[model samples]
Target: MFDDLISLCLTGSPPALPQDWWLRWSLAPATLLPLLGLLAWLLARRRRPLPLVGWALLALALASPLCRLAATLAAAHMVQLMLLLAGMGLLVLASPPRAHMPRPGPAAAVHGALLWLWHWPPLYAAVLGHAGLHVLALALLLGSAWWFWRAVLLAPPPWRGTALLALLATMAHTGLLGALLTFAGEPLYAAPGARAWGLEPLHDQQLAGLLMWVLGALGYLLAAVALALRWFAPGHPVRRATPAH
Candidate 1:
């Protein structure tokens, strides 16, 4: 019975990708709406222009074909996770130079909870099994990450120390989770047809853990550097800059 279940799970790979897989991935309903919203934002603020980098990152995060194609691989999913959580969140906060930063305490708790919950093996497997649920998970991750980063980046100068400590705590906790996955003797998840790609489930899981531990933590480190620079760089009150006409 257990062997039959394993075989059944192995056969459950993603639907055959179309010849126009790139086009489909890019134009997927999940991918398109954010692109349009970004375009509208750019058009509305034409006179007082925001940085293009943020917009570009947002487009890729929301519209890239790589995201859907890579879903079959845990590593790819981790990359997508980073793109949405760290990449898109950071870029969006960087856009409006003067937005108010939220309080770190609540934002950190929510973000940390969302991050850990979605990555739990059962929930992660469920997400892979259902397209709608996968989208919902992405939405929740992106939203929570945005809130967390906004709070971190927009923190007033006085709160810089607290923000830094919060970031360190986040990095430590998330990295610990990644380490747990990395060192586990057996696969923690039976992801959709994970064997179809010729990867053993344990190896695939290790790859995902490495991405989270290394790449995800790297994102936080970069943010920490940025924050430290802003906080400690000699005597210029870091006021929000007015967008240039």
Candidate 2:
């Protein structure tokens, strides 16, 4: 039964039939148990709607049919990553304000490094083939993203400029990676399953790259713009108070 459960959790190969796509939900105990615990905690404490919504999005990305699709399609995998990052960002934004968060510069650097490391073709291919490695990769990605978001969002007003710079730097690196993938002459990922979905491997890779280049960078871009606007707004924490006549 344990082996059966493990087999059930494995995404296996891509679905060849259209109906199989919608039916393939990953009810992994490793994923579902923690999500259930989180849900109970959220309900018990009566958390705000934003965190709840974020939790739902996280569940959708990890436990829904999307998880199975991600195993086969690079583009679907990109969507899952984006959803996880966005969900983590929302959760951070809704959390109670705290002091002494890590500096955005170091956090951004670590997150960017991890992002690049995971995208290395050989490593990524291996991860997709092994469920344990795939989970570990996602855990590390989400952990770093959480740290980066917290650093940027919770930094003191005086450090907002630094945060903004870090955010833009992240955006730049991710966009550059995406551009590289998009323009590569051949398929970077060995996704033979893409043919089952009527997509050439190169085309699938390019689509994934486009999603990362545009959609992935969008979150950071919006955050950077907001931070800049707040920095220059009247009476902001970083702004000097004007003297009365």
Q: Please provide, for model 2 over 1-245, each residue's C-alpha lDDT reduced to its tens digit, 9 standing for 90 to 100.
A: 11222233344654424557677666667768988997887777676787788888898887777776776778887888888888888778665545556788889999999999889998887777787887688789999988999888776666778889999999999999999989999998876568888899899999999999998889789988987787778876642322122
Task: Go through the candidates in order and give each one's C-alpha lDDT.
Answer: 0.65, 0.78
The stretch of ten residues in a row with the least summed lDDT in candidate 2 is 1-10
lDDT at 78, model 2: 88
**Which sections of candidate 2 miss by over 4 Å?**
1-17, 44-47, 236-245
In model 1, which range of ten residues has the least summed lDDT? 1-10
lDDT by residue for model 1 over 52-145, one digit each (tens)? Answer: 4556665554455545445556766677677666565545554553544567777888999998998888887777666667667767887887
Give lDDT: candidate 2, residue 212: 93
State residue 177's C-alpha deviation in candidate 1, in Å. 1.5
